[model samples]
Target: MKINYSPSKNAFYEEEHKERYLLSGSWPGDLIEVSRDDFIEYGGNPPEGKTRAPGPDNKPAWLTIPLDFVEQAKAENKRHTDEANNYINEQQWPSKLMLGRLSDDEKLLFNKWLDYLDALKEIDVSGAPDILWPTPPAEPAS
Candidate 1:
């Protein structure tokens, strides 16, 4: 029937739901009438990555929430970190073999992997979404 938006909370409130769930919470915005279909399309008041905005005719509108590059970068950083961690986890045992057990070439590859992991740590992902992922070392032979 009618939807109101709270800029402070970045939430949408249906006149009915507001009274039921958020009796004391502030739901600020001139109530705008929208069709039931429109309400469902907005996913119960601006689903993640979206926010409500005033429509051209003073109806209601939804727009994409601005991309958070810093958060994106952090997520990218974590992804790369996790990948490297898994690689090292799976491949490090061969490096721990008894001394002289590994051929010279095998040791070199393992060391290369570790070096890549170290380089990854030094990367500044605060600039995330623009990260240059380090090249993984060639998987070493066991």
Candidate 2:
């Protein structure tokens, strides 16, 4: 089994089901080969609340997930909630539905978005990279 570095995952794939990277062939990143001992010691995936990154001289090293991650998550969640609120409140979509201007499906979609926005606002990013983000109504959120 060969270990390949995945910067996006911030960790190494000890065997990395080839289909995910080799077949897709779209993940552009480093190709550092890690020894089995290193993999065993540091783990294929970074430890909880931490991430892998290139350290001195570009060698793989484990680093704690930084405080910036919390701030970043807060900003992202705010952006999503703001957008959703704009559609529901600022745009008066619910009023449109009440006035028979919108379809039932659109109202349902907006309702789901309302729940998703509330979930986003309640997220606790104190865990930084360990945070579990809420899913969006129509798609995956950051």
Candidate 3:
């Protein structure tokens, strides 16, 4: 079977170590090899290429990662997201829904986060800002 990197995953294997790079926990797992077809599909770059390998053309252009490592990384990421979502629901949601609206201090904090969320798509997982639910729309004019 061929191993392809999960697009949803934020971690990868460094060609230098020939081991998976975990963005968080360094869990142990069995080593898995990638098939030639899968490697070609991933556009894997050969390690060191001509300078170190048999030659640039002779080597593949991708690195392989352990299958178990991929699963572990995905699970860890999910756990983090779930915890953050729960915190937002419990801590931030009620504050936002209060009848009188947020205090100046709260509003400032929320707006800052709103701005940050607007820029979140471009951020890496490690750099992502706290979860910020959308603010309610302003009331209509009298």
Best model number under TM-score: 2
Candidate 2, residues 8-58, lDDT tens digits: the string is 465666555756766678554665777877667666656666666776645
TM for candidate 3 is 0.33
Q: What is candidate 3's lDDT per residue for 98-123, written digit by digit as tens?
A: 76566776566455544544543332
TM-score of 1: 0.42
Candidate 1 residue pairs that clash:
73-128
lDDT of 1 by residue, 18-44 (tens): 665555655464555556675667545
Off by over 4 Å in 2: 4-32, 40-48, 91-102, 115-142
**Model 2 lDDT-worst window of ten:** 133-142
RMSD after CA superposition, every candidate = 11.1, 6.7, 14.4
Q: What would the C-alpha RMSD of candidate 1 be, to one decimal place?
A: 11.1
Q: Local error of candidate 2 at 27, Å?
A: 10
73 in model 1: Cα distance from truth in Å? 2.0
lDDT of each: 0.63, 0.71, 0.41
Off by over 4 Å in 1: 1-67, 94-100, 140-142
Q: TM-score for every candidate vs. truth?
A: 0.42, 0.49, 0.33
- Worst lDDT 10-window in candidate 1: 3-12
Which residue runs does candidate 3 get wrong by more than 4 Å? 1-61, 92-100, 107-142
Candidates 2 and 3 compared by TM-score, better number: 2
Collision pairs in model 3: 44-61, 44-62, 45-61, 45-62, 46-61
Best candidate, lDDT-wise? 2
